[model samples]
Structure formats: structure tokens, C-alpha cells
Target: MNLLLAAGVLAVSLLGGARQTEAADCPFDEWRTYKNTELRRTADRKAYFWITSRTAIDADGAPKAYHPDDVGKPCGATGAGLDCPSNAGYPNKSWWPTVLASDPTNPSKAFVQPSGPAKGFFVSKTALQDSANGNERDTARYVDASTIPYLVFPRPFFQLVGTGKPGDLGMAFHLETQKQTAFIVADIGPDEPLGESSIALFKALGGNNPNPRNGSGVASGKVLYLVFPRSVDQRPRKWPMTQEGIEQGAETLLDAIGGMSVLQACATLD
Candidate 1:
């Protein structure tokens, strides 16, 4: 790991949510190195393990509200001691919720629906480490690389795990589409409401591709395939907030990825 790079992440956090401000520039040396750095600095090392799953209902049974803080919380573990810098600015994680209006006649308060494929909550971890045995994949009790990509990968923007345990305010919900394709995951809290626009994200994911799996059986679940397209042909006029803006914002930000496709296509390359 580069001392200079690690120092840079620490330097950023001093500025009050610096992790969120300058995440785009963090260097990717190795996943372990990245995560180690975050664990060293943040509260939860595995917080970034996230995915797009069915929209979930909060304890109050109300829809979620879209907050960038909630989206950044998973990757925010850098503050807790994980390796990777929180808000490394990778455009990797996807957390979308519906945008509601303030009028009763308008009839859109962003509530979680009763039934649909986008019904449950989305939860996943990028790499599962057997902390007990100090084992990761391919080590008899470690996280297998081949199986990593198969478990619902996060949106192509960020590259941290969004995995949080049950009832940790570690989950997010989508309230827009009922289709199985648009579900994204986030940390859940009891008083929190479900989000509507993020639900749209749960619906926007492209189909899964056949990801290579090592000996481990981590790839057998119903996972979402995060495809970083080649050449972001478009740009965003502004940050996403509204229905159209959210998807458009994601698409625009995703387009800015450099060599994301090449790297993703040959992800196994050392």
C-alpha cells in the first residue's frame, strides 16, 4: 500500500465528512488493502457490502426518504477503521428511493408496497471473511474470488461492501417499481421510512451475466449483476433527485467511469 495514498484518505476525513467529499480520487491497490484502510479508520469495516434488492418496509411501515448520508453510510466505514476511504467517489454503490410530493390528492408519499418482486430488502456483502480462522476465499474457509462477483454486486459506481446485520438502520427501500430487477440494498433503522426513487434503481439494474466462480459456492444465490458499461456516452446536467433525474443521474455518473468495463470484464486479472 502507498503511504502517501493512505495518508491522503486520513487527511480528507479531518475536514468533516471528507470521505464523502473526495472519494473519487482514492486509488485501488487491492481490495484487502482498501478494506483494511477503512477498518483502520471507520466504525464498521463491512458496512460497505451492499446490493440492489427488493424494496423494504421500515418499522413504522412508511416509505424511505432519500438521503445521501444513508447511501454513504455503508462505505462510510472509513471513519470506523476499514481500509478503503469512505466516499471514495467511485460512483459504485446504488441506493435509490421514490420522490414523493406533498399533496394528498397527488397520492405519492413513497410507502413500501405489500407485494412484488421488489418487495423485500436488499442485503449483500462483497467478500465474507472468516474472522475466526483468519481465512478469506480459497483458504478452506475464506471468501472465494470467483464467488465474489456472483453475490449481488453493488452499482458500478462505488467498490465497497454494503453489508450490515439485521436491524442496524442498515437497509434502504425502493417504492417505485414492482419489477424484480430494480431492487437495491441499504442499512435499515426502526424509525426510518422507505425511499421511492431508490426503488426505481432496484428496477433499473441490467440482467446478470455469468460471473466466474472459484471453488466456493458463493455464487449460487439470486444476485444482481452490476455492469459498468463501456464508454459513458452521456453526462449529467445536475445531481439526481427527482424520478427522471435519479436514473439519469446514475446513468450519467456511470458513464464517467474510466476503464470500468475493461477492468470489470477482466476482473480476475491480477
Candidate 2:
């Protein structure tokens, strides 16, 4: 093993020992490092560990609420194309780039709906989907971020963690704060940044803002994400996960890693 992987294995082994669990035999013990983040996996294939700096706000799958008041009326005020940046000084919608697809025909304009019921709605080209609706290929409905608490991944993080697709991974918790919440791997973000979640997720984690453009912010090293690769498959396939269901799913995954005490015992990355 390389130096980084060897160090990760030693760290994980020490952590496991601290919790009195058998030392984890990490098959994919290789550690990927970013700004201040590190991720690893267990030999048992139970989870892909995430030690992230912070979690950002994501509004993609949430209801079509963008304005400060959570209303969509401003989205359709223009009657021609979606009022993408209904607010002035943001015509390009730079803060909200992930939602809009590029207009191949018009290099400057995004491919937002010109006029319709879903005119101002934003859909993730790959990650946004209603899990309860149907198969991702045929009947998958779009996710509503307001209704569901969900986690998001950077494009590269998805491949790095080895989760097959969006909605396959499960669960996230704040280590230092002890804030545990259930989340579907619901959205894919940019290539480098990580820790993006739905408005509801932010609220669950104790945030006041639901606006994607200018929501709340948290400092780095506050949130810790522990993902069970394909753990949603542990339970029966179902759409529209309920709070009770989310909690139960979280409980199950947490139990797999020996409960909160497992990581809580060693929240700091050595």
C-alpha cells in the first residue's frame, strides 16, 4: 500500500480499536484527499467514510420555490422565459448554475422552459429524481427538496465513493454536533466541492434559510457524512421516503457501523 493508504488504514484501525470493534479490514483503504477532506471505505463493503469540511445548501430537487418568500410567481413574471434570476444583478444566474442546462442553440441563455406549469423549475440532469415515482430510466419523478431531507455529491465524489447512482447511498450526520439525519444521495454537484444538501436537510441540521441562491452557511469540519453504498437497497424499493422511513433507514445503517458511538468515539480525523 502507498503511504496515504497505509496512514488511512492505521487511522481507521486505531479508531476501530478505540471503539472496541475488531480492526476494520479496509479493502479499499486508499484515501482520497481534498482541501481538508478525506474519504475511505471498509473491507466489509458496508460504507464509504466521509470526513468533510462543511456542507453547502442545495435547492435543486426541492419545490419550485426560489424567491425569499418561497413563492414561484416571480419565476413566471416575464411570461417569455423563466425569470431565472428574478432578482436584478443576477441575470446570468451564476449562483444557480447547476440547475440550468446550457442552451446549445443559444450560448448565452440557459435551456429553461419558456412557458409552462414547470417553467421556472430546475432539474438535475443526472441526480434529481423522485425515488418513489419509478425506475430512473423510465418513470423516475423529480425530487422535491422542500419535502425531503437529502444529501448531495460532487460528480467526482460519486465515482470516488463507488456508489452506482444517485439515490443509492444513505445517511449523514454531524459528528461534533451529534446531529443525525437520514438523507438520500439525491443530487450531484460540481467536480470539486462537496457537502451540498437540500433545504430540508439544512433545516434538519439547524439552518434557517431555504433559499438556494443565498441560504445559510456553516464552517468547515462541522459535518461528517457516512454513506452506505447501495444501502437504500437494504430496505424494499419505495418512493417518497417518509420521515419514519428515513429514520428507520438511518437507524439500520447506523447500527451497521456500531451506532453513533462508533464514529462519535473518534470524530476528529487524526
Candidate 3:
């Protein structure tokens, strides 16, 4: 075996021994990391694993109510405006649930409709689009019937995966034979689902689903997710991430976890 891959195997072997002892006692509320854990079998016949990170849903399901006090008159005014955010009607429409800024910001200008009764968070318009090709929407961002990312087995658990706060760098890693890529938890999804990633992240991991938004490459659970909670990079303090920035961020995270050498082995795997 190559040196990097060999080192990775050794690291996993060492950590596996330690994790085995604590596996029986790990707390439910605290975050944790996992290695080489198998996910649900996929049709594509790939192996999948996961690391500890919290995920939320961002797609359509049931309708939820907004706080009356937070409700405005719609269309940026009071008293019978055009139902500004959701336009569903008075008290039925949704608003930015959390205060993103003291004064309204440009990127945070849009409003999201209630996907279901549990809906509580919102993401920027840019978060729903792709940086590399500039696709304006994603399956997770829509409430349509044909979307692939929207799951029914466990209800519609679609949302950007991140802390509601902007610039949150919570991320998940997709590992292949000798390759891996990083993705920021830029949106949220259902609370029950554990294996979801952004369309961009899915594509980066070599997913062949035709529709970037709906079809998942990791369907067979061949991908491994190494999630880093509350790990957002604070230097840029920006929303939509650049490709270069994402690559750098991935390296930074691997470094933090002492997995860089292991990842190097993965990159060179045959």
C-alpha cells in the first residue's frame, strides 16, 4: 500500500480501538466522529461512512405558523400589502424567523414559505444556487413533486445543513476510494435524516444523479460523511463559498482533525 493510505489505515485502526471502548458510553447530546461506518446500501454499490455532525431539513413537507409578533403587513409595508414574504395570506405567510441583521441586508432579502409544521429556519438565495455553474435553484430549495432530494420514506427532510447563523462553517466530507471533497452545511433539511449533503457537495463527490437538485449520487450510501460541527471559518465571514475557498477549507478541517495524512492516502488510492 502507498504510504499515505497505509498511514490512514493505521490511524483508523488506532482510533477504532479507542472508539470501541467509548462507543458504549457516548452521550446523545454531544457531537462525535465516526470512521468507516456503513450507511444504507445504495444501488450503485459503493461504501459509505459518517462522522458526528448535526443536520436539519430544508425542503417541503407540512405548513407551520409564524410568530404573530414577527409577522409584518407583507410587501415591506403594513395593512394589506402583497403578502410580502410567502403571500399565502395574513398570518399564514412566513418571515425571516431570526434577525439576520439589525438592518435588512441584500442577500437576506428573500422569504421562504412554510414547508411543514416543523419549519423554523431560513437560508440565503445564494445558498440555494451553485457557485461553479450558477444554477439558480436546487431540489432542496423547491417544494415541487419531481425533486429527488426530497425524501418521503422519512417525510420531507430537506433544508440546508448548517446552524441558522450565516457563515456557519459546519461541514461534511465525502470520501471515495482515494478521493474526498468538503462541503459547508449551507442549508437545512429534515431533523430525522442523517446522510444528506448539498447538491454541490453531492456532485463534487462524483454523484451521477441527472438532476443536481433531485438525484443523489450517494443513494447506495457509498459516500462517507465526516461532519464538523460549529467549524465555520471566520476569516471571510461571507455566505456563498468559492471553489478555491472550499478546497482550502477542507484542508483546514482535515488538519484540525489530524486526518490530513489519511486523506492524502485516500487521494492516491487505486
Candidate 4:
């Protein structure tokens, strides 16, 4: 029994030493660079860019909604004349519609409702705080869908890189075909799912499915994200950025990332 116990202790010590040696061989600092820029490619040529998502309820505790029909309707039948709805979807209080807002161009339109079943991209109140409209975290007017598309990097990276901040532009490219799209870093995401873009941005890159907000358009390990930190346009940021603008921005971003040559090569093959 004494011999057996001694052997068991030796074996445990050896195993622990092996683990310590392996850990020492791979230091955290060496891998920390991946936290800011990681490009993972699969055998099938699919790529994944890891980043976080920042979609949460506003200070008033309301989820954001995008309503296309809000062009001409009043919010409710009474109260402060605010056009907010009472039953907007998820992250919103069941009794109060805090994230609702009216169309600035046409106030007669009803407040935009939560995207119950439809598919689209709209910045959350948390995201809207960084926009040109200033911080309206408490008001229903924070739910505008016409805002420019953007993404958020981890807060540490955001501070370190000083780019991809709110309103700054970034680009996502498809490696196999070298197809690309442009976007803004307008919102933050959770920690685990590091790399995420809006449904609209994903669609722009040829991702299937209409609703990305509901996790329908994610192409995991397929899109390559190249972010340009602090690349905000000098002119006033346009709402619902034009297709031409998107295309031009993509082209510029591709050139910046040295993907123009790859894009041309792929184009010639097609």
C-alpha cells in the first residue's frame, strides 16, 4: 500500500509538471495580439473574424425597433404626444415602449414599432448614444432606423487602437471571391461572439437570409472583417447611406487592406 501511494503521487506530480511546462511555452502576451485582430480560416475557404457585439436595452430599459411604416402615424391615442408604442418586442418593458421614436421627416406617422417579424438593422439605444444625434438614451427618439451602419470593437481595443470607434468605418471581405462591403462601428456586442456585423452589412456581403438581428444571417467562419479605426468621414454622416457611398467606401477599404489586387484577380476568374 505504501509503494502504491508513492507511485500515485509521483505520477500526479509528473502530470502537473507537464501542464506547467506547456503553459509556460505559450504565454498569454504572445496570444494577446489575437484579441485585437484575429483571422481564422477553415479548409473550405470560410473565414471568421472575432469581435464582440453590443446590443442591449437603453437606460430606460427598452429594446430598439425598426418600423418601415412609421412614415405617417401617431404613436398612441393619448399621453405626452409621444409616438412610442407600448408593446415593442424584446429587451423592452412589457408595459412601456421606451425605445420607440417618430420619423423626423413626417411626424404624423406612428412611432416605429419593434421588428416583431420583419428583418432589418437598427442601432440599439446603447449604440445610438455615440451617433450625431447626441445621447438620447432615455427618450423614445433613440430608435431611429435610418442611422448609418457601424460596429463596435471591445472597449480595450477601442481605446488602444483609437479607431473603429463610434461612427468610424470598417470593411468586411469575402476571401474566396474577394467580395467586400463597408460599415461603421456604431455599436458594442457581448464578449464571447467577438466578431459580428449588422444584418444589413452581412447582406451587403451576399450572406443569405433577411433577418440578421435574429441570428438568421450569420455565416460563421465565412466573412473577413478588416476594420479601419478612426476613419470617420469629414462630412456630416448621412442617414441611410447611399448604395453608391457603400460601394465606394468598400472599394476604398479594399484598397487600404491590399485586397484590390485579390479582388481583381477573382473578378477576372469570374
Give a tens-digit lDDT track for model 4, residues 28-74: 11213444444322222211233222222111212334333332334
Query: Which candidate number would show the highest TM-score if scored against the true structure?
Result: 2
Better of 2 and 4 by TM-score: 2
Candidate 1, residues 1-270, lDDT tens digits: the string is 222232233223322332232222322222332212221111223222112222221111112112222333553312221112122221242321111112233332222223443232111112222335431111222222111111222232223343222111111111112112211222232222222122123223222221111111112212212222211223222111133332343334323342222112221221
| lDDT per model vs. reference | 0.23, 0.53, 0.33, 0.38
**All candidates: TM-score:** 0.23, 0.63, 0.40, 0.47
- Residue pairs clashing in model 2 are 53-221, 61-145, 62-145, 130-141, 132-239
lDDT of 2 at 252: 71
- The predicted structure with the larger TM-score, 1 or 3, is 3
lDDT accuracy of residue 256 in candidate 1: 39
lDDT of 2 by residue, 1-270 (tens): 222233344345444545443334223354567545766665677776666645666655433433223223344323222123443212345644445444556645434444455554432233655555553222125566676787777777667545545655465554333345677777777765667787677666556554555443442235656677776566565455676777677667666666554554444443
Better candidate by TM-score, 2 or 3: 2
1-270 in candidate 3: lDDT tens per residue?
A: 333454345345433443332322311122222132223211221211233223222222112212233345333323221112242223332433221111234433433433542233232232322334432222233222112122111123223232122233332333323234545544433234465444344444445532322232332323445344444545444444565675566556555544544432332221
Superposition error at 53 for model 1 (Å): 8.6
Displacement of residue 84 (Cα, Å) in model 3 is 23
| Model 2 TM-score, 2 decimals | 0.63
Task: Predict model 2's lDDT versus the native.
Answer: 0.53
Ranking by lDDT: 2, 4, 3, 1
